[model samples]
Every structure is written in C-alpha cells, then in structure tokens.
Target: MVLDDLGSSLRGTLKKIANAVHVDSKLIKEVVRDIQRALLQADVNVKLVLDLSKKIEKRALQEKPPAGMSNREHVIHIVYDELVNILGGSRELPIKKQIIMMTGLYGQGKTTSCGKIATYFKKKGLRPALIAGDVHRPAAYEQLKQIAEQVKVPFYGDNKEKNAVKVVKDGLNKFKRSSDVIIVDTSGRHKLEDDLIQEMKDIFKATKPDEKLLVIDAAVGQQAGSQAKAFNDTVNITGIVLTKMDGTAKGGGALSAAAEVGAPIVFIGTGEHAGDFEKFDPARFISRLLGMGDIKSLLEKAEESMKGKDAEKTARRLMSGKFTLHDMYDQMDMLSGMGPLSKVAEMLPGGFSGKIKDIDMDDTQNKLQRFRVIMNSMTDEEMNDPSIIRASRVKRIAHGAGVENRNVKELLKYYNMTKRMMKGLSGNRKMRKNLMKQLQFGK
Candidate 1:
C-alpha cells in the first residue's frame, strides 16, 4: 500500500473543493496546494508533482465542462486524468517466445522475482524456464530450484558452475526447445561495483535477453531512483518489477523512480508466494492511490491469484449474496494465493482505511495462520455444514488445529453470523445495490 496516504488526503482536499459553488482563483489555488502537499508527502517526484498540478490547474480553469457534468465532476475527472498520466499508462508485458533478463542489487529479491516472473508467464499458457545465472550467492541456485518446483516451471542452474555467463549460455541452448520464455536470473552486487556490473554486461551479451527488468525493493524509498540510474547505466532496463510492495510505505518512491527513469512497472510482488505477483495496472493503481474505487483491478488480482473456474464461481456467489461459511472457506483458499489479508485489503477499491473504518478486521498474520489451521482441521462435511460441530467435535477439532476449543467455536460463530447477515442483506434490493456499488466502486 505505497502512497496510501495520498488517496484519503486528496479526497479530503477534493471534498473541500466540492463544497464550493464556483471554481474561482482561491479555490484553484487551494486545490493545487492540497495536491502538492499530498504528492510530496507520498514521496512523488517534486517536478512531476509541479507539472501535474499545473496541468490540472490549466484544465480546470480553462477547459469547458462537458454537458450535464457538474463543475465538481469536471474537476475530479481532470485530476484523475492527470494523476493517471503521471503514473504512466497501461503497458503489458510481451508474451512472445523470448528471453527476459532480471537485474538488480543483491538482496533486492531478484532471485525470487525471477521465479515469480516465470510463473506469471506460465500462467499465461507459455512454458517458461528459469536459468539461475546468479552464482554469487551459494543458495541462489537452490532457491531458484525450490521456487521453480513450487511454481512448477522448468529450471536450469548448476551450483558447481562458478561462471554465470557459461551457465546461462549453456542453459539457453539446453532449454531452447522446451521453453518459450527463458528468464535469466543474473547475479547482483550488494553495492554498485564495477566487477558486478561488468558481469551483468557479460551475461547480457551471452544471453541476449529480449527484456531486461530491474527488480527493486519498494522499501528502498528515495534510493530507488539512484539504484535504477546505476543499473540503467550498466544494462538497458526495459521495465521494472517492484518487489515487497505489501510491506513498504515507500512503494510510491520506487514507482516514482520507475517513472523518472522512463521504465514502466511490469509486475509487482505483494507477497512471498510464487502466485502473489500481479501485473501493474495504471488506472486501477491511480484509483487506489486517489482513494477512488479500483474494483476492476481488485477483481483481476483475485482472479490471477485464484485461477480457473473456482475463482469465477466464488466471485459470482459474492455478487449474488450467496456467501456462506463454505463460500468463505473457498474465498479464504483463494486469498491464500493472493497474499496476506492486510495486503489484499489495501488493494481493494477504497483501500484499507475506508474498508476497515467500522469493523475491527483482525489482520494479524498470526490470526490468519490460526484461521488456516482451523480450516484444515475441519472435515469436508464440517466445512460445508458447521452446525454439525457439537461441543465434543469442537474440542477435537481445536486439538487438531492446535488452538483452544473456544477459538474453534468462535470461528463457527463468526461464520454463522456472517451467513445470517448476508442472508438478511440479500433480501433487500436497495441494500444489495448499495453494497454492490460500494464493493465495485468504493462509492
């Protein structure tokens, strides 16, 4: 949830403007100032912010409002457009049979990102193979192998081979027939050293990758720009993969850096799992940043994580108010693929702040871990029919899940309460409409 503060703050500023009847000089100044403040605080590039504000001001003051559109709506549209423009437009990764090379500093999650990238392509029906060219770290090869197994993608790496260039060259020839996408995971340096940069250049020459992606940790904040510059100087990076965005407040910084470097973000890592990677969508991302709803993006994330017909059926049930404990369990299983509850909550249309305004969502990782354990302890019949779980069964299930009997009962109680609530809300058309709209648009 990088740049998370921008949404609420910008909304507050816009709300003040909406209260005004006319867009005068004073109102324009106030709006511009508010936007500037929010952007700066969110760690957006200062020059970019100034240019965006100028465009927004120019448009708001000079451009004629569309017929039937109020001044407020007109102003909001201009602001949204400007923000999206600065955030960059939709750019999709090419899915053709080509080699993709990953570059970054050590410990920036490049190794993990390579596996995720391979998995992403694999999910698109392309057979991808990962070549572990990173020979610096002793465990790098094994890590790639483990991730490859988890993602079920083919892998080629030799722990015994010290020469990364030779390994990649050999891997390219060996896996050429079977793999459509060859991702060469190059070595990284703890800092920008000449030797490491030269090594990456050598690997590039050997592999001749189609795309060079710089994997950067979102937590690097302002340094992200400098790091991008350093890597860009050595290797021509076509795109970026921002990793660990879920835990970083400086995701905005990394994104701004990508924008500054003229590199579009291709994918983002929200969690540690192989399936937790998501394609970067500018419109949905800008909407999320502005605290406007990003229902489309949220749904896309859900679909990517869940995969296949089960995700579709669950989404249909959610829309139809048929969400039961059984449905909740199914949703939970999908959520596991998506990432942590906190990360998923942040990606929702209204972001985490709006969604959890009234409810005390227990988003602690330990809580989710416990819930997962409890679900595993349940029999298939029990999962579908919670009412069958009596006191004795609860105790046994609690022991199986490694929690107290009270926790098991509490989960069932919550599930039952949620089911009843959904049932009651299902009967009211107006309420359902409002709920759907809220879920869809965060309105």
Candidate 2:
C-alpha cells in the first residue's frame, strides 16, 4: 500500500483530463505538476522526476494521438509508458539451469528472498537448491533451511564453517546433478564492509555463479542507487530484487533509484509470505500502480489456483450460465491461493477495485470461508440447483455451518450476484466495450 496514494494522486490528476473538453497546454502542465508532487513525496530523486515529467509533457503535447485515440487517451499512454521506463523496462530472467549469488547489506531480506526464488523456480517445475554461504549471520542457514523444508527443495549449509567460499563449493557439488537452479546465499555486513566484499569475491571465484542478484529493501529510498552501484562495482549484479514492497511508502524511490542504475529488476517481494513473491513486470506494475488493474497478473494467479480439466470444465459451465453453489464455492476457494483479497482486488480494473478498498479485506476473506462452509453443508442436488433450497433448507444449512439462517440467504445472494455477473458477460457488449476503453485509458 506504499504507492497506493500515488495511484489516487495520479488518478485525480488524470481525472481532470477526462472532464476537459479540450487538450490544452494548461491541462498538461497541471497534470505534470501533480505527478511531480506525488513522485517527490514518494522520495523519488528530484532531477529524475523533472526529467521524466519533461518527457511525458513533450510526448503528450508534440506527438499526435494514435489513430482513433483521443488526446486524453494519448496523454495517459505517454505517462504510463514513461513511468514504466522509469521503473526499468520489462526484463525477464529466463527460467533455466543456473547458479545465482545473492548479495546485499545486512537486513535486506536476502535469506527470505533466497527461499522465495527457490520456491518460485520449484513451482515453475525447476528443481532448485539453496546454498547457505552466509556463515556470518547467526541462524541464517537455519532460516533458509526451514524455508527449504517448507517448500520441499534441496538445501546445503554449514553453520560452523568460517570459510564462506567453501560452503558454496560444497553446495554446488552436493546438488550439481539433482538441481536445475542453484542459489548461493552469501553473507552481508551491517554496512558495505571490506570483509563482506572480500567474502563475496571469494565465493565468486569458487562458484562463478551464472547470475549475481542484489536484494534491496524498498524502504531504503534514494540510497538504493548508491547501494546498487557499490555492489555492481564488485560482482556486477545481473539483476535486482526488491523486498517488502507492500509495506514501504518510499517504494517509488527504491524503484526509480534502481532504475537509475540501469539494472533490470527480476523479482519483487510484495509481502512477507513466499506466495506473495512475483516476477517484476514493469508494464503490469505501472498498470496496478495507476489503479488500472493488472488483469494479466490476475489471470496468472487464477491459473495457479485452479488448473487442468476441472478448471476448464468450471469455466465452461460458468460461461454457459450453468453456475451453481459448487461453482461459487470453488471460485471463492481458488481466491485463497491468490495472496490477499486486497492484493487480488488491485488487479481488477475500474470501480470494482475501488469498491474493494472501501471494504475490509480480512472480513471479506472470512466471509468467503463462511460461504464455503455453508455450501459444504448443502446436498449435491441443492448445490447444483439453489431453487430447491427453501426456508427449511436455509435453516438446516445454516445450523450445520454454525450460523444463522440469514447467513445462508446472504450466501445465496452472493452466489446469484456472481452468476449474473459472469453469465451476463456473454450479452453485455456495451459493458465489455467500456471496459476495453477504461483499460486503454489506464482506468
């Protein structure tokens, strides 16, 4: 929620354009000033903000709107594209067999990110192994080992070993044949100390890792650039990883600072949970940041929750308007797999996401669980067809689910709402067209 306010600020600025009948220089300047203020508050470097604002202004005014697009749309596109560039253009790390070395100042969440990366690779069907090369930090190996066990991946660590390079050597040899990706978690000093740099150099010589990653804390703000440069001077970071993205209000600073260094960010830790980690897609990130839900990311998380023939079959039924309580239950249950309710809401475009902000995310999640429990108490025939569930059935189901009869009625209402919304999509041409327009306008 750090950049949440920025989205509102940007939206308010852009909303002015929506009301304007003409695209004028005055309007452009106003929007640019609003952006500058928002970025500055987020701790973005002043010069970088001014430069980016300049580019946005020039493009919005000088460049002709694309064919069939209005000036409002064109100007919004320019802002979106420029912001994406400022956060580093889309850069992907190919999922393949490789060795990655993790380095950063102490307390950058390097160890947690190590587990997250390994878990991410494992989910992608790669056999990932973690090497605990951070012998300096107490319980560092234990922390990663616990994560490895939870994610069920191979892990190698030696707590007593004083030579960090030896740990990397032994870990590589230990999982050479069994692992597709080997991640070396190296030690970090409180600051950029000589000993820590030398230790990293020693590990670099020992393993010659395929990629060196610098895990950065998003709260570091403008200092992120200097930290990135210092590490890149040594091992030459192949990519950057930002942690605690969900908590920091100065996330814009970290993002812009890292981009200033021209290092492509590979992954971002949105929350403390390993499941909250996601690949850093600049375009989608900017989309979410601007309040124009990231549907692509939403779909990706959806696929993770429900897959194979069951998911396919459910989709078919919903499209055909054959939705049932069972279908609703499965859909809501699948949502649990997608990090948090508010997080998932941010990926949906338009008023829907704004509505989510007004509600309690945890309370919503708890209600979803209650819905699932209520449905579980229903008979197969009743779940398949809700019409048969009269007052008697509602009372019985509620009693079984440990709730009042009114709760059952509320669940039925939610199911009907979902059914109508999903089924109406087939006939809602105007709604679909409006959504397309909003998505193009950055919502």
Candidate 3:
C-alpha cells in the first residue's frame, strides 16, 4: 500500500465517523481535527491542509446529505473528493511515437525510473527504447543499458561521449525509426547547478522531447515543490514522476507540492521492483488511500498479470465443480504474479479490505507458500482427489514437505471448503453468469 501510515490514519478517522452515535457540528469538528492531524503528520503543506479541512468542514455543515446517503457518508465523500483535488488529477500520455526526456537531481531514482517507465509502455503494447543521456555519471550508461536489456528494448548510449546532448541526438536517430516511444534518461547533478541547467537546456534543444518529466523523491517532503519549480523553470517540465511513494510519510508533501506547481503527477514508482510503476490517477489513488478501492485499476492489474494463462479453462473447470489442488495452485500463482496481497487488498472496498488487513499478510503469504509445498508433496491421485489423503498419507506428505501433519490437514480443510464453495457457485445461474462476465471467462 502506498502511503500506508496516512491511509491507516485516515481510515481510523473515518471509522470514528462511521461509529458515531450522531452526526452533528461537534462530530464534524472532531473529524476535521483528526483529518488535520493525519494530513499534517503526512507532511502535507500547512496551508493546503487547512484549506482542505475548511472545505470539508463547510461542505459537511452547510450541505445536505443525498437521498441515499447519511450525514456521515456525505462527510466522508467530501473528504475523499477534496483529497483527490489536492493530489491533482491524472495526466494522460497517449501511446504513440514520441520522445520523453527525464530529468532530476542525482539520487532521485531518475535512471531507474527510465526503465520502469519503459516497462510501463511495453506492457501497454508499445515499443519503448531507452537512451542513456546522463554523461556526468560514469555508471549511468551501463545502468540504463542493463535496464534496457532487462526490459528487452533497444538502447543507445556512448559511454565515452562526454557531450550529453550529442549522445541523446545520436541515440534518438538510432532508435527513431524503430521505437514507438523513446525515453531519454538525462543527466543530473548534486544540486541545480549552472552546468546542469545548461546541459539540460542543450539536451532539451537537441531532442525536442514531447514530455519533459522531472522525477522527484517523495521523501523530499515540502522541499519537493522548490525542486519541481527549479526543474520546471529550467526545462518547462511537462509532468512529474514521483519515486519512492511506497511507505513514505512525506509522499503527501511531494504529491501536493508537485500539484501546486501545476505539473500533473503522471506516474509514481511505488517500490524497488521494475513492475512497481503505475499511472498516477488522483481519484483512484485517493480511493485506495481511503480504503474505497479502485476496482478499475484492480481489474486492469488482473488482466495484465493473468495474460497467457488459461483463465477460460480454469473458469470452465470451476463451473463444472472439478476444482482440484492443481487448479488452486494455478489460481494462487496468478494472484502472486499480480503483486503482493497487501497491495491487492488496498484496492478492495473499505468494508472488505479492512477485514483482510487484520490478518497478518506475511503469515498468509507464508501459509500460501506452505500450502503449495504440501501440494507438491502429494501424488497426482491425492492432488486430483484429496479424499484419498488419509492419516498415514498426511503424515508421509508432511514429512516430505518438512511440516507438521496438521499443516497438511489444514491445507486439505481449506481445499475442501474452496471446492464446496465452487460447487455452490457452479449451481447458481445468476451468480455464475455474473462471475463469467466479471472474469470474462470462456469469451
């Protein structure tokens, strides 16, 4: 979950509202104060925080709840909308032939972001190429070269060439004919020095990039605004890419600061992994942050992660009430590929996701792994038909997997429960129809 602490705090405050005996002026003020503390602690700008709180308070007090909504629900809605506005809305970058120039100070994860952004485009069915334009740093060329290979995209760089502008020009020419999207990882400095500005100017003039993105570290807090303005002044920055968003308390500061500069946060790097990059959509971001869930993004992740897998076949098997451990293993693998369970949970509706958060995710993940291991120790007969896994077989399987016999029993119990549920769903016409439509199974 990105901004884990802030999300938890906000959810706690909202829970207070949900549990309140009555919705009144006093309750509204208390909720407003709680929100103020949460936003301030998350490093949001003081003025921005105050302004947001005031708007929320005014709306909650002055406005009437909708016909279907209660006062508490209406107040929560106001908070969600205001938070989204402060974070700024999504910036659309079309998938087409264009050059993107990435710039930022050194240690802002700019180089790695080039790779992640390239992966993002590649996943979108676009051909993206990487250009190593950071000439001041000796390792930038090799690092980006490795990243290009990792993403299986064409790369251009002249490590011996000290002229950053010339490197970009040559690289653009090299990949211009073949690549759909060319991303140039420009040079950075220790500070916004004169030479850095001049080099960036030269590169900007040379490439005529369609998008000038400034990568900012979310941990920079309020200072990110100054950095964003400085870079924007230098290159007329078209967008911002926030890195290190996961688990950062100061992410709110970076987000709001970037928004204040009027450069939309086009993307965010959530973690160290190459797959951790995501398009920044303020409404969806705040939705997840407030535990409202972004079903759209969740479905998108599922479609992307489950690619090449036989979802239709699995759906048919499930509908036929023939779900075996083998089928369950495949399902688990698909879930794991989608990313961590915590992240997926964050995309679920508040009511359900909150319950999931109570269970230790680490323990659950380990248990999933343990279940897979236990299944691996079973014979095809046992895996396909768990009814044959008697007491003696359980002990032997547990010993093979280096686990207690009870672990095997637990796996069997879980499997039986899942199988029974599948059987029930298979028999329900309306539920089955909806499930198939949602899964797009057997399409």
Candidate 4:
C-alpha cells in the first residue's frame, strides 16, 4: 500500500484504457494527460513527468501490438515499463560477507534502516552485526543498540567515545571474526554539515564498506536528489534507501529524484516494523501500483511466514477441505506473520487491491484475533468438530473468551462459510489447480 494515492490514480487511468473501444491517438493523449496529472499530484518532477508522458504516448501510438495482444494490453505494457524506468530499474543489495555503511541527514530513519537492513540480510541466512557509529548523538547509540537487541543481532558501540571512526574500526575488528555482514550506522546532521561529511569520509576510509547507502525520507520530495548527490559526493553512496514511503504522497518525487541522481533504490521501508522493509523491485512495484498484482512477492511473503513443509501441509488440507479449528488457528498465525492484510491484498491479482480499499482492515484483524481467542477457549473435541457445539457450549465459549454470545455464533458462521467455500473449490479440479498455482504451493 505504499503511495496508495498514486496507485489509485494510476489504476483509475489504466481502467479507462481497459474500457476504451479502441487505442487511437485521441485516447492515447487522454491517458497520457491522466498519468501526468497523477504524477504531478504525487510531487514528481515536472520535466520527468513530461518526458515519461511523451514516451508512453509515443509507444502507445507507434508501437504495434504484438501478435495475439490487443491494443489495450500494449498500452498498459508501455505504461508499466516506463513507470518502472522512472522508479529506477530493479536493484538488490547483495547478501554476502560484506560491510555496509549507512548515511543520511538526521531524522531520515538512517539508524533504524541499519537495523532493518541487518534483519533483511539475517533473514537471508547471513550472520550480521550492527555497529553504532553515531557518536554525536548519545540517543542514536542507545537506539541502535536497542534495535540490535530487538533483532537479536550482534551490536558494537562506545557511548563514551566521541570518535566515530575509532568506533567503526574497533567494531569491525570485534565482529568481523564472527559475522558475515557488518552494518555501520553512521551519524547525521540536520543538514549537510561539514563535520558530518568529514565523519562519513573517515568512516568510509576505516571500514572500506562494500556498500554505502544513503537513506532519505520520502516526504523530502524532490529535495532528495540534492541530498543524495551531497552524500554521494562525500562517501560515494552505492545505493539509496527511501524510508516512510507508505506515509508520504511525495514518494513519487523521492523515487524519481533518487533515480535521476543515478542512485538505485536498493530497499524501501514500507512500514515501521522491521519486517515491513523489502527489496526494491521496480517491475513488481509498478505491477502492484497499476493494480496488476505481484504474485511473486505474495509467494515470497508466504514462504517467509511459514516453513515449506508446513505451508504444503496446510495447503493440501485446505484444498482437500479437511481442516479443523486448530488448522484455522494455524492459518491465522501464518497470515499475521505475513504483515498487514491490506499489504497482502495488494499482491492479489485482478484489481483486487482496489476493491480491498473499501474494507476496514484493522477491524478485520481485530475480528481474526477475537476468533483466535474464542477458539482458544474451546476444547479439542469442540474445535475438531463444531457440530457438537450447542447453545450451552457457545455460551461457555463466549463467557470464557470475554465476549458476547453473538461473537461466538459469528465465528461459527464464518467457519461454516469457509468450509463450504473450500468444499466447492475441492469439487472443481481446474479452479483448485489454478488457485494452487497462484499460491505456488509445493513449487
């Protein structure tokens, strides 16, 4: 759900393309104008927006639709490609034995991103250590230390020592023997101060980091280009990290500006949680933005939420229409691990993300939690076979779960509805196969 406004606008424009009778010059111009308006509203640079509009218009009018592809599909394809290009082509930070130094102005979530990057590499099977090089702010040292503890990674820092270069030098020696990936969280200023530049250069010299990432807040708008350039001039930034991308309407400006400055966005922080950060994949991002869905990312989230064997077992049980309340509880657990329901819905195909915008996701999550509590209050027999739950039992469950009787009944109703739906799916072989294909089960 990052840049939801822009996504909604773009999806609206694409919807018109789908509804058009023919892909003529008039329709192409209209679509281009719509895109330009959306990008401008999202704070994209005027020049970049105009250039992108021109490319999309030209491709739509001049490029012939491939064999078996319709004009509408061709136009959509061009839009997707150009959008990806402006957002910068896909680039992922290598997950290997290396050192990465993080830089940025203060309040850009640089220290926090250090922990997120460590979590990312750690989840990728690398042993990562966090080094707190922000010697100027005592709070930053404590913050990174806490984040390191929260992520359960090795941390090195010296709150008493004022020299950040020495801290990085010592931390590298301390963790290099045990860790594969060492991440240094450098100090930042309110603006690009000379002292901050000197500190960055000194740390760069000491660590000789494999990657120098500049973190910028998406709310900074087009100013991010100048900021990225300043940091790149000092320490030669290898990539960029855009934080608070989900909260800002100016995310388009930040993305395009960073790309224009020649810094590939290697990672983006979609939400505050460490798990909410993800590698920047321009194609998948544009696909989600256009409401085309990102099945690959959805599958990756599923795989990350649960082990392969457990996922396959659950998938088979659900497809076979033989799951119990215990299975349902496990399902809820997996869904919770996959982050917010809205984010998961974004990856669903067929413009489903647009429809999901209408649902109250927080209420849905609360209801699921209530269901879990109600199931927890039930006995094993009652869970395995809901048929035995009479009025007295429902009353007991409601009382035990600290809810009204209607809540228990509602849970029961939902369970029955789900079972019936799964039963219907099990009866349809083709539909079941397609569903499994989308889920990437057993693949």
Comparing 2 and 3 on lDDT, the stronger one: 3
Q: What would the per-residue lDDT of candidate 1 be over residues 217-262, giving only the tens digit for each residue? A: 9888667888888778778788888899887766776777676777
Off by over 4 Å in 2: 293-443
lDDT for each residue of candidate 4 in 179-284, tens digit (9 for 90 to 100): 9999999888898988888788888889999999999998999998999888887677899999999889999999899988887899999878778797898888
Off by over 4 Å in 4: 294-443
For each candidate in turn, the TM-score is 0.63, 0.65, 0.66, 0.66
Over all chains combined, what TM-score does candidate 1 have?
Answer: 0.63
The TM-score between candidate 4 and the true structure equals 0.66
Q: Report, for every candidate in turn, its global Cα lDDT versus the true structure.
A: 0.75, 0.78, 0.81, 0.82
- Which residue pairs in candidate 1 collide? none
Clashing pairs in 4: none
